[model samples]
Target: MQIKRKLTEREQKLLQILINERNKGIQEIAQLAKTDIHDLKTIIDSAIDELDLSFLNQNKEIDCTLISAYNEKLKNIEHAIDRLAEGNYGSCQKCGQPIPEKRLEALPFALYCVNCQKKKEEKNKEATQRSYPMREEI
Candidate 1:
């Protein structure tokens, strides 16, 4: 059990504040964030619309499914935050190595280190390839 370095006190406080604020109902959260509720509503609405377009390509029939998918992604982000609090953040889930600080700074919810993430993506690409192998000429 490796004890990863804990986030700084300031960072931890900031993260906790942000998480608590973000989870509140949009109207209340927007008030707490010092922004207009209409603007926040617009942002969330646009995000859901963009997700729907990307997932269903303008098909209305799948809108609910797309919304569920997007909500699931948000849940995963929350889970990553829980992992961070448990002193397991910034370490690759697959290889158990420390992830680069830069990566963690850029993406607070990342689960795998860069190398492992890249290799996993490459493996997926190879496994999902649709082309046939070429034959050698005699």
Candidate 2:
């Protein structure tokens, strides 16, 4: 019979810590997202009533930006929890590799390894650049 080796003490400890983080991240992010989103519409309406055209436009824009950011975080946090349940919490979704402990600790909801993350960022930058019109086309 092939016996599975046991995880080292440190690895076990790190797993427990990650599980804790996954739980806490889910709870905290859910609450934060709900609160932020709940007030978004009301805040934008208030800004329209209380501010001049320029300020109102800016305030509404800022409110939507914040809500979108929060929603992204909430989505990541929830997905992290799901990954933890699936026994792959610390693995990179893109590379199928274990994400570094430090990176996972710093961003429990991270979806990619460092190298993959860099690549993804580079691609995003390229896409952004391509979307802009050339001066002549403008």
Q: Write the per-residue lDDT of candidate 2 for residues 13-52, one digit (tens) a residue.
A: 5456655753453444335345353344344335422312
**lDDT for every model?**
0.57, 0.56
RMSD of each: 9.6, 12.4
Off by over 4 Å in 1: 1-70, 129-131, 135-138
Q: lDDT per residue, candidate 1, 3-118, as tens digits?
A: 26668764465355435533553544344444566765566556632422243344454444534454555455455566666765567899999776667656656779988999
TM-score of each: 0.45, 0.47
Q: Give the poorly placed runs of model 2, Cα more than 4 Å off.
A: 1-11, 19-82, 134-138
Q: By TM-score, who's the top model here?
A: 2
Query: Which stretch of 10 consecutive residues in model 1 shows the poorest summed lDDT?
Result: 48-57
